[model samples]
Target: MDIFTLTIIVSIVIYIFIGNYAGRSVKQIDDYFVAGRQAPTLLIVGTLVASVMSSTVFLAESAFTYDGQMGPFVLFPQMGTVGYIYGALFFGRYLRRSRTTTVAAFFGERFNSHRVQQAAGLSIIVALGGYLLVVTQGAAILLSDLTALTYTQSLLIAWLSYTAFTLYSGSKGVLLTDTLMFLLFMVATLLFTFYLVSDLGGISAAIQGLSQLEHKADIASWHGVIGAGTEFPTAMDYLIWAIIIDISWGIVFAVSPWQSSRHLMAKNEHVVLRASIYACIAAGVLQVLIYGIGGFINLANPDITPSESAIIWAAKNMVPEFLGALLLAGIMAAALSSASTFLSLVGFSASNDIVRPSSPKKTLNLRATRWIMLAIGLLVLGASLFLPPSIFWLTYFVGTVFASSWGPVAFMCIWSKTITASGAFWGMISGFFLNVIPTALQYLELIDLPSYMDPILIGAACSLVVTVLVSRCGHVSRQEKVYRMRLHRTPAGERDLKQTKISVIAPAILALYGCVMAYLMVTFYVTPYQTASGQLLPNGQVDWATGEAFLSVSWALLYIPLALLTYILIWRSYSPGAKNIEQAQTKA
Candidate 1:
């Protein structure tokens, strides 16, 4: 066998071994669902970053960067950095304090309704189904490109590797394996980036080459706008849509089940808080380097198609054989980490929220969870194998669903007390349908909508509006209101609630960052620099050299420092002394 196959096999074997070993520690439902709530800061950080990055970072985002330009690539990580900070401030401590095994369970408990919990679970299953399918398909495409295996065969192998480990180790196995894989993936990504830059004769040469392209202004600018009749019909549409997408994605990143689950599993609330900082640092650094490689590759060879396997194409053609294999392994690791986490989450929701809520025996619940995980793994695998590749659109659809359906209700539950159970439930239902139905109709060619009307924005707005209006119309029972008031308080008093530094500062920081990003984007729109016409007389154009300088200086002076400040604030505010009220209730 070639070194590539041998290396991949060895990595898969190690994953399975670690998973099986971790499985031996599973003694009850809790152990399987939340890793006994004992995960440390590093493990939580690693798993969260690994799961969030997924194959999208290596496959889909790379392709988008190559096809569209560096504008979105630079914007992507900035959104995540803000999202992590938002999550740390708004959800991290509260989720840990809630002590629920899943976000669905938290909804159930907070609202005092099993139906809401089940609804949330079903939504998660649907959204994650699309997400897992995309990741699995990306991995399969990479493998198929490298070897003689067909797509189906490659998919089956990917399925078996993740399913076996998930069935054996559950969340513990997923966490441990994810940490190890994250280290490997990061190192491999950095090495790949280095090789790509060197092959292009260093960063300066790469930037110079990009500047000489016909669409150099668009490629280098944050708004990706070019001459009067460029890709976007109007420059404002591009700018507005770009900002909306970034903000929507950031909100989803903050509150998604995959991320909240990590918070639930941490050793303590402090770990959860601190891990967000680490995750932001890891995600920010890696995204800039890896996506930079993608943009550079497109500049070097515009002939390369921006397919789902674009990064793999870069790996095979730009790097040495051994390095290429290692890079492939890293991509595999990215897929496996995300697939395992999502699979385990589906399993946990199925058993704990849907099934075990009937109060089944611990042994029966544990056994059922494992079986459920296997079933979900197989189901998603089958779907991926049969489905046409739609990684980019599917990712957008799923992200919108999760963000629109869950974001408003989740924020209300954690921060407010006025929302009734009925309001939350109906809000989710309305948001989900409103968001999905329009997109589905559009996809089926039954409806034609204007390009500017983003379903995600409309749905999220409707969800928030419905939640507020319905909540005011409905009233919570006195007992439920009392329960909510109690939930809001802590042993350290209301000061503990008020002491969240992130909550106080993040909004201001987010606004400032958004303003700065908008300014940079506006500069792109007005700038008249175009290699197509080579027109220096327009005065509206900013030359490629000037654009590149602005981008470098803004990224250095504005984006990086803001990200670092957010991290430092989160670290400084982490309080180990804060107590978990829900854990106290459990012990009692």
Candidate 2:
């Protein structure tokens, strides 16, 4: 086998071995489902970032940048990163306090209702099953490219590789292997980014060069390359579309099963908080660089077919052989990490919440979970084969499903004293169907909705309305009231004043970094554009009016406010003098 195929094969073998090694320690249901609830910040952060940075990031998103939609693409993930902070403050710590193995179980216990738990579980399987299918197709495509095999043959190989380990080790294996894979891909990404930037004559030259290219005019602008036949026909159109979908993605990061479940694996609420801070930084930086790489790949070869394979193609042709193989392996690592997480959660929920809820047999529960995972694996494999691959759109569609269905309910279930179990259940169902039905119909070409009436926006609004209206009809139970109050109680052991102070420092530093980034943009991007007032456009003449209009409303100005707001919010919630900390310490 050539280096590409050989590298992927060896990587698969290593992943399987690591999964087996981690599996040896799984003795009970907790060990299998939540890593015995003892994962540290690094491991939790690894899993949190790795689990979400799958083929969706490496392939689907990269394609958007490659196709010159970098402006909207970048905005979405930056907003999503803030969800880590939101989740840490409002949702994650409460989930940990509930001491539940699954996110659905947390809902079940919080509401003191088994039906709500099953509803939540059913949503997980449906949403994440579709997500798993997309991730699988991503890996299959990568495998097919490297080995020159048919899509079906590559699909089986990719499926079996992730399934073998996920089936054997469960959460424990997924967490450990996810961390290892995270380290591998992160290193590879940094190296590849550095080489690509250098090859394109550095960032300054690349930006300048991209600006002068006629066919890709306005590519480096905030709206991307908007015009006839483009994704966004005007700057306002791009802005409206990006903001709605971007906020939905932010909700996904905050409340989605795959993302928030990592908090359930954390050793403590502190670990959850710290991991979110770290994950926010890591994910933001990694995605920004990946989008840049995607755009940079276009500078090298603009004719990449399917567009999703731009990164894979660039790896083979743009870099050295060893580095090329490493980039391919990194992409595969990203895909596998997310696949294992999604598949493991699906199996965990299916057995723990659906097939037989409240099983007293811990050993039996563990055994049955593995079998269910295998069954889910086969089902996803079969479905992936039939689904025509629209990698980016499929991922975007499935991912945002949670933003509407689970987002409102997830937070309200934690903070709203008036939200009843009946409300929560119906809210999830309403948000789910309302979002899915319209989006699917639009996908089928039956109807067309304007950008403002996007399915996610409408569905999220429906969920919130239904939840509040339905909540008024029911009474909050004593158990539910007590559970909600209990979630707010700060445990004595978490009261490390020094650590809390240190944690507060991170947000402050992030705020400072945001200012610095904004300054860098003004210096490198804005100043250059301003100086190019006389630079010829595609028509071989300057359009000073349009350029001046863009400069008046630069995206850079939004950074400082967003960053400072994040810091203020984090400080109020996380400072040592915060109500929870002060109240608990005084009692102590």
Candidate 3:
């Protein structure tokens, strides 16, 4: 066998070994679900980063960037940085403090309703199922190109490798193995990116080449880039839509099951807070490096078609034999890390949230979780093999489902006391259907809508409005009102005004930072000036001079400060006093 294929085989073996080793720790449901709630900050950070940066980002987003549908550096890194920071301060810490094992369980406790928990769990399954299909299909396509296997055969290999560890080892195995995979992928990505840049002569040469290309204007235009010239439709084509999608999707993604569960696994709220900083930094640096490589590769070899194959093609054609093997292994690592996490999540939701809640048997629950993991793996594998769709569309569909259906309810549960159980439940259900039904119709060519009217935006608006309206119309009982008031209380005690101020001020500062960055992006990157004839120009379609200015200013002024500020805010929020407060709460 070739060195690349052999390396991939060895990596798969190592992952299975690690999963087996980790499985020894799983004697109980707690260990399986949340790693016994004893994971340190670094493991939590690693797992969170690995789980959140899935094949979608490495394969699909890189493909989109290679095709010039969006600037990965401009969009993804900023979104993640802002999202995780806000999540750590507002959602992560508080959610961990609530001591819930799952996001669905948190909804149950927050609203005192089991039905709401079931609804939340079902929504998670649907959304995560869609995400898993995308990851699997993306991996299968890449593997098919690399090996002589058919897509179905490639998918079976990928699915079995992903499921073997998850079914045996549970959360402990998943997290530990995910950390190892994170390291492997990080190294491979750095090496591949370095080689790509060097092979293109340099960053300056790459950019210049890209600028001189025939599609230079199209590539640089943020609001008008197409996919493979025609095969994929333009989804993000306006400045306002891009801004909203990035920030909104970022926040929802941070609180999603695979990401937020890391907070629960942490040793303490302080770990959750600190690990958020670590995850943000790692994600920001890696995204910029890898996506920069994608852009440079496109510039070097503009003839690489199908766009999604750009990264794989660069690894094979541009790197040395051994390094190329490692790069391919890294891609495998990315795919498995994410797939394993989602598999485990679906299992946990199935057993703990959906099944065990009604049946209430510990041993049966444990066995059932394992079985469910296998079932989910097979189910998603079947979907990928039989009903495969384009990577971008699948991701967009699932992302919208999660963002619109679960996003509003999750935010309100953590931050607001007035959202009634009825409102949360109905709002989620309504938002889900409203988003899915129209998109399904659109997919079937039975209806058409304005290009700019994204389903996610509409669904989120409708969900938010319904939630507020229903909440206002309903009344909480005296006892439940008091319970909610307690739920909102700071662990440091409400008497501690200093802690309260810190809580409020941290998010406020981050919000200010996000707003400033948005303003800068709009002013420097998205705005369009009129021509000499007084005709208006299209946004994000700038002249060469304007493009140079935008790139230079954004590189120096925007991302650097945003990164630094994120670190500072996280450091400040995880004070010794915060730990003391948490300890005191534990004692109480």
Instruction: Judging by TM-score against the true structure, name the best candidate.
Output: 2
TM-score of 3: 0.84
TM-score on alpha carbons, each prediction:
0.85, 0.92, 0.84
Instruction: Put down candidate 3 lDDT per residue, 1-588, tens digits, no spaces.
Output: 878788888999999999989999899877888899899877987898788677777777777667664343553335645567667666777778777778788777778788888988998788888888888777777678888888889888988888888899899999898898889988888887778778877654555455445753455443336555543265444454556567666766567777887888887666776677667667766776766676667666866778778888887788898898898888888888988888888877877677534343434457777888788888888778789557776677776676778778777865666789889988898888888888788778798765556677778778889998998989655654555555545554223434334434443444444456455444533332212212224553434354323443453355456545654544444443544432343235
Q: Write the residue-wise lDDT of candidate 2 on 245-346 in tens digits.
A: 778888998889999999888998778887887887888778878987888787888889988889988998999988989878988999999999999999
Question: What ranges in model 2 sit over 4 Å off?
Answer: 72-77, 355-364, 529-578, 581-588
Candidate 2: pairs in clash = none
The better candidate by lDDT, 1 or 3, is: 1
Q: What lDDT is obtained when candidate 1 is compared to the true structure?
A: 0.73
Residue 275 local lDDT, model 1: 77
User: What is each predicted model's overall lDDT from 0 to 1?
Assistant: 0.73, 0.82, 0.71
Query: How much is 271 displaced in model 2, in angstroms?
Result: 1.1
- In order of lDDT, best first, we have 2, 1, 3
Which ranges of candidate 3 are over 4 A from the true structure?
70-77, 221-236, 356-364, 478-483, 486-588
State each model's C-alpha RMSD to the native. Answer: 5.6, 3.6, 6.0
lDDT per residue (tens digit) for residues 352-436 in model 1: 6775434434434677677877888888987886789877777888866877888899888866768888889888987888899
